[model samples]
Target: MRIGVLGTGGMAAALGGAWARAGHEVFVGGRDGAAAEALARRIGGAGHGTPARAAEYGEVALLAVPAGAAPALAEEHAAALAGRTVVDCTNPLAPGPDGVMLTTRAGESVAGRIQAAAPGAHVVKAFNLVHASVWDLPAGAFGETPPAVPFCADDAHAAERVAGLITAMGWSPMPAGGLDRAVYVEATAAFVIGVWWAGGSPRLAFPEPAHPSA
Candidate 1:
């Protein structure tokens, strides 16, 4: 599989490196050409270049940029992404008066906005539930069974392809639902981040024995 990474941040480095290590052809692209080239070298990626060029180079385009920038970038590469698999790993969380909040408009998710911007792309929401450091480790390090990576997508072929890529990391790919379920997943990430910011483990509420995959 060929993957085009669209950022130079932690998520891009971590997941892109994992994919490259899994024998997928990876191309990195960013606003900063030097940084993109550096990351490409560090991750064993096949090449590096402008985001639009990278978008055109791969079967799958991994949108690892900041949530606020995702839609515009998708719009910029809409033509390249047409009929291709687009994997969205962004979480639109921001600080609010009360606490952490999902930054997207009510009833709309980050993935939905990306889908709207690149109408022809098969968008899938994933890799937002956990921190990038979690992906930095080997999948088997967690436990006997690899952790399940839950995701949502509107297109079946896109979902299956993305699920196969997720499984290549040795993790279980749990399909949550269609694109409509993305809002829930994003909200959960926001809540989970808020608890972590407050110095609490969101996982503490649900014991492993009862909620193994939570």
Candidate 2:
């Protein structure tokens, strides 16, 4: 798969590296062309000038930028992303002295906002629950087993493709249903953030259920 990662941050680096390792073509883009090139060099992928170019070059475009920047970015790449699957990995994180709060409402989600901006794109909400460190580890780093990463999207085919990509990254993919369910998933991100605050650990993961015997 040709994947375009739009961000030069830790999460973008982690995921882009993993996808490159998995034999996929990846193009990373950012505001600064030099920084994007540096990130691509580090991840062994190509780098592009603008988000629109990256979106045009990829079969699936992963938006790993800050959540607040999503709408504008989506709008910028709307034409390029037409009829494409866009995997949204952003969380509506509102930061302040008090800490981070959910910027999205109880019934709305970042994925939906991006979808609204690019109505032609199939937006799937995922990878927001896990830490960037988890994506940096090897496939067997979590022992012989690993945890599940839950996601949701309105389009079934797009969701399935994204799920396969998620599995290839050494994590189990738990489909949490339609895109509307992203509201709950975003809420869960807040829940996970709370847990991290209380436990003082940002490396925790949600356990996957074992398969039943046939």
Candidate 3:
């Protein structure tokens, strides 16, 4: 798959590296072209001038920028993203006295906003519940083995594609449901954040389901 990643952050770099390692063609784009190029070099992928260029280069695009920046990025790359599958990997986190706060409403989410802005694009929510660090860990980085990462999307094909990509990175993929299910996914992210803060470790991941007895 020719994948494009918009955002020069840790999450973007992590996913880009995973895809590149999985033998997928990946192009990374950011506000700083140089930084994006550097990341691509580190990740063994390609880099682009802007978000639009990255979107244009990819059959599928991953929007891994800040939740606040998601809508603007979608609008800026609307032309490029038209008729393409877009995987959303952002969390609407707001600064608060205690900790980060979720900025999305009960009915709305960042993925929904991106879909609304780029109506022609197939926007799917994913990668919002895990930390970037988890993506780089070796297989069995956790205890006995690695666990599945849960994600959701409205578009079944897009969801399957992203889920396959996730599995290629040496982790299992658990599909939670459609786009509206993003609310639960984002809330789970907040819960994960709390658990990390309390435990002081980011290496932990959610456990996968056990097989049922016959």
Best by TM-score: 1
Candidate 3, backbone clash total: 0
Query: What TM-score does candidate 1 reach?
Result: 0.95
Per-residue accuracy of model 3 over 1-214 as CA lDDT, tens digit each: 8998998899988888888888899888888989888888888746556777788887789998889889888988888898788988888876567766788887778888999888888888877777798788876676675577777777777887888888788888888888788878787777668667677554456343596563
Backbone clashes under 3 angstroms, per model? 0, 0, 0
Q: What's the lDDT for residue 157 in model 2?
A: 84
* CA deviation > 4 Å runs, candidate 1: 208-214
- Tens digit of per-residue lDDT, candidate 1, span 95-122: 9987899988899999999999999999
Clashing pairs in 2: none
- Which of 1 and 3 is the better model by lDDT? 1
Better of 1 and 2 by TM-score: 1
Clashing pairs in 3: none
Error of 2 at 10 (Å): 1.3
